[model samples]
Target: MPETPPMTPPMTPPMTPPWTPFALFGALAVLAWGAAALDAALAGGRWPGIVTGPLRGAARELVRQRRRTVMPDVPLVRAGVCALPAAAVLAAVVLPLGERPVADLSVGVVWFNAMEVCVWWALWLTGWGVNSLHPLIGGYRFVAQGLAYELPHMFALITAALGAGSLRVSEIAAAQRGLWFAVWMPVAFAVYLVSAVAMAFWGPMDRPVGSDIAGGVRAELSGPDRLVFEAGRYLLLAVAAAAAVPLFLGGGVGPALPPWLWTALKTVAVLAVLVWARHRLPGVRMDRFTRVSWLVLIPVSLLQLLVVGVVVL
Candidate 1:
């Protein structure tokens, strides 16, 4: 007789159905529009104009001429142009909408981190591909900013994972049912938010694309390329804001509405804050931010990690 196979649990269908991947695209579109409209509103644009502003810009770019620099690396330019939004989508794969993510990986936090790292690569490539002095400086600026923030960003994520005693995003969210991590782990939460801005190059952390450099990395881009690049920037912002929900805002634990709704509200709130900061706060100088990140943010984030580790123990 054949040896008996090892005993195994029977397979079971998942209780909660996840939204289709297209929903991810829809979320991206919504986020892009919101960022654009709010940016316009903050810039003193009125209601109807603010609402249609993003669409009009897209249309304008569609018909406009594409700019090219001498000796431009076309392939590298395309890679960088596409990377931002792609990274955002992939990073969000592990973030649950209502307690279940699109990917639901065992190491969702790690997955998210990996995707975000890709963004630095994307920006640097875009900057270098253009073969222009301003864009090149812009690219290096992003690298410096990344060095400043990536450590603290990683520590913040680790703190959340340690607090929950798991890397699965949903598990992290579930662990917060009693109390939000943001309450006790405020340091990490705050650092995470700040790093989110840095990671997306948004608002006060947007030195890479600052006015001083005349749009910096994207200065040479125009037409459809510019359209895609702008959309990708907002996409990264949206992903950063959405991740904060599962990482700190108690995921989907609100009383009145469904988990997905709660997640959406929290995400939108975070997104609004990130976008508002663009107008509310002047950008930080990279030189100062570099010092602050290593001296202050890193230490605080590490301490938050220690606190979470002790709590778990």
Candidate 2:
């Protein structure tokens, strides 16, 4: 009894340091950059040639010369169109995970907004550069569509940031440790999701890529140029989903698995949903979409922000 010693509590394993995300992000950045650059350089100027070259000899023998269709505006549109997706891939590289790197940056929300705005610029340039009527119309339509959705989207985002009392995305994610913003601000989440689909021109919101009329903005592109746009769409969807994970679904918050894996899985799942919707939903008319965006989506998003403010206080 005299020799009996007090027993100590069992030790718990140490949580992985948040700094590990930096290394993971760096690797992702390098891979994305290399792929994007290679895609741009090879496909921008010679896309049609790249696509039809092998078939040309066979086509010459089987078809009349009059059947040959000259591919249009490969150089200009290709160069401009390649830049945004390239930048998006680059942004994905630098975006912080698990934690914010520079906590004191005052304009963190501004940074995210700026990046999102670039998506429209990149898309517009691609359409305009094509020097084709269909794409130009598509580009113009994109601008109009953007006007309809961007304000509401920004309001929702700003409300969340303001309510959380931080511009930092990491901080916003952290604030939802006890309860996610989606739970409290369900309307904002819904508005954000709808706007995100519209902004990316995906699925039912895919008026810009209308297969029925004008064949959408990317109708004229071929070869690697077409590939770039196609790939860019996927990347945009992936990035949007990734951004939303932290904002709504509780980023990397799970029982098992590391944080980074959880983030990747969530992003992939969102992309899958977009893909499914792309096949399932019919595209809406541009006029109808615009009206819905302004009349319905905007007011709802604004109200959601007000709700968030009340809950936060």
Candidate 3:
């Protein structure tokens, strides 16, 4: 009895509250809406358009009729349309809302990249399922775009992961306690940003959905179908912008604001730049870009990765 020690409570992993997914979804929705609003504002050259335009357009789509194509593959079309937003949301799970992520998976970077790859599948499905010439071409365009951008993008991501010696996005963010990876790995950061636009098919990289092809993959969709697809695209763009914060920028790092506020501000800044780029930059053809991406981008990214490795060592 004299030697008996007090019993200690068993060490247990903390249980995530059930509301976590809902909170993450709510945050994602807000960010996506902000992106849509910003794009609308930039296009219209008025601040008020930001608030009203997106809402008005969404309302119209919700009530509009969904036009059916001749002998359309309904199941595939539905799957692709649904998967787009799902992939975007899944990708956002790794992105920390403030100081913590919803999932906080050990391989957050890989998870983000994998979810992004789903866009290729989604595009192909939607385009092919429609059984239309323009959509098919648009799908082909995206496949080509992905082939060109993905290698350099992967290298850029690897450079960051290598620098921090961790694939976990939170750890990468934590590694930049003093100097941000963007400052030192500027090349990688630039590459990452370019790939971000390409991944979202936004701004100058929007050839897949170019007006020349009459809305491309989304040309045939209408009503609620169109609404969901457009919303998914905005969500993808927002998620890409959000992912940049942890990968290149210092996540939630800032001087005065709370971490979550810092994250939101940084994300908005990135989203604005992406939206503005659409107005400023001219679209490049996929063939020309493919040549440049392979020759210039791949080599440059590799060199950046080498430089980062040296610095890390």
Q: Pick by lDDT: which candidate is best?
A: 1
Residue pairs in steric clash, candidate 3? Answer: none
Clashes of each: 0, 0, 0
TM-score of predicted model 1? 0.94
Per-residue accuracy of model 3 over 195-257 as CA lDDT, tens digit each: 878988888899888899998998888898888889899999999989989888999988988
Task: Please provide, for model 1 over 238-257, each residue's C-alpha lDDT reduced to its tens digit, 9 standing for 90 to 100.
Answer: 99999999999999999989
TM-score leader = 1
The C-alpha stretches of model 2 lying farther than 4 A from their native spots are: 1-76, 90-94, 100-106
Candidate 1's C-alpha runs over 4 A off are 1-19
Clashes of 2: 0
Clashing pairs for predicted structure model 1, backbone only: none
Residue-level lDDT of model 2, residues 91-119, one tens digit each, is 45323455432232345556666666777
Q: Ten residues in a row with the worst lDDT in model 1?
A: 9-18
